[model samples]
Target: MLLPQALKKGDTIGIITPSSPAPVLFKARYERGLSQLERMGFKIKEGKCSKQTQSYRSASIQERSEEINDFIHDQEVRGIISTIGGMNSNSLLPYLDYAHLKKHPKVIMGYSDVTALLLGIYAKTGLTTFYGPAVVPSFGEYPEMLPKGKEYFEDVIQLRKKAPYVLDVPQEWTEEMLDWNTQDRQKQMVKNTGWKSLREGSATGKLIGGNLNTMSGFMSSAFFPDLEGVILFLEDSFKDIATQERSLSMLKISGVFDKIAGLIIGKHEHFNHLNAPFSIEDLLFEIMGETNIPILTNVDIGHTFPSHVFPIGIKVKLDANQGTIEFLENSVSE
Candidate 1:
């Protein structure tokens, strides 16, 4: 797998609005996010779509794709991060300058709807992409980015720490929501109950996956990465039991369960059980139909605060019996 150069203190990070017009909709929070990045000692270059808005999305598909392509050709930009995630990032896939990105690789990171881009880029170029925090919901949080989330980002992208290490579960986490425009303080956090080992086993394979619902947009396309022997991680937010069934069934029907080595499920933000008598775990087992792969759930990753930064295509060891996840190698090069 291709690794991007490790980001340094003074490197420029290009910010693009591939889908949502968040910078315009939440101007105050958006500026705060940029301020936080500046405080981290990184230069910020706002792409054309950063300030543009056409109702739901920042711009048209052509404009959105061009914004990313512009950053791909920019020599000074060492990384690109989404301002926020929305529904149509999949629309930008076909128009991206994948060949240019493959030749001049850089760190590309975001979560939620941006999963389409992360997995798509990794599939197209074999360059590792990040499934982590985005500007608005994460970095733009009232006072600043959550400390653990910041550390994970720096550790992976900025190379503050090396890999071949186990990931730490934050002692506390939050899924509380506050209106961004009128928020005054931090969201209320609760003690982490810890990861659950749904199955007792272990496996090591390449790590690949992101927001479970977002995968539906491109799962059938060439953009989706191969699942063969991969330790797949999936997470979603505000989804009901029915939605969960459909999404899980998509993978089941696609032969994903047969191909993957292990599964890591991140903490679902504001999940709606739909008053089902069965839990999501029970539903998952029903859909999986007796696959014996190791499965770990309630791990901290995705929409929740202080989430871990997962580098797509990196080698990882998943020990479901012990509820541990370890990165087997560094995700970025010096």
Candidate 2:
């Protein structure tokens, strides 16, 4: 995988609204995130799509693609992050300047709907993008960004910590929902049970996957990375077991489960089971149908508070029995 340089003080992060016009939707929080980024010793370059909005998305596909390509072409921008993720990021794929991005090779990070871009870029350029935080929902949290989230972000992008390191499971976490514009108090914190080994075993491979639901839009495209041997991690927000069944089946039909070296299931943020007769795990096992590979569930990674940043396409060891994942190398170069 192509590694981008580590983020440093004074590094300029280009902010683009690839999907949702979060900057306009939540102006105060958007500015708060920018202020926080500046406080962290980085300069912010707000993109053309940042302040623009058109209901569900920031702009048309051409405009969004232009906004991102502009940043990719900018020599001053050290990194690129989405202001937030939404439904239409998949629409910008064909128009992306992958050849330019491959030559430029800068850090690109975001989650949820931005999965399309993260994995697409990685597949196109072999650049390691991040399944991490975004502006409005992460750094823009009321009062302040969650310390653990900030630490993980810096630890991965800024090299605040070294590798061969085991990710520390947070003592507590929350999926409590609050209106972004009206949030006042911090989210309700609940004790984290940590990772669970649904099946006992271990395997090491390049880490791959993001929001499972988002993957549906682009998984069949050439932009999607080959999951021939991956520690496949997946997560979602507000999805019910039925939707999960469909998505998991999508993976199954694609032969992902059969080819993957291991599996890591992230904690679902506000999962609605719809009072199903089966658990998510049960459904997963049913869909998987007698796979012998190592499997870990409820690993704290995506769409959840204090989530660890997983560098897409980086080497990782998945120890299902120990319920741990250890990074084998630093994701960013010096």
Who wins the TM-score comparison? Answer: 1
lDDT of each: 0.94, 0.91
List, residue by residue over 113-177, the lDDT tens digit for candidate 2. 99999999999889999999898889998788999999999999999888989999999988888
Off by over 4 Å in 1: none
- All candidates: CA RMSD (Å): 0.7, 0.8
Residue lDDT tens for model 1, 221-244:
999999999999999999888999
Candidate 2's displacement at residue 36, Å, is 0.9
lDDT of 1 at 308: 94
| Candidate 1: clashing residue pairs, number | 0
Global CA lDDT computed for model 2 = 0.91
Screening candidate 2 with a backbone cut-off below 3 angstroms (N, C-alpha, C), the clashing residue pairs are none
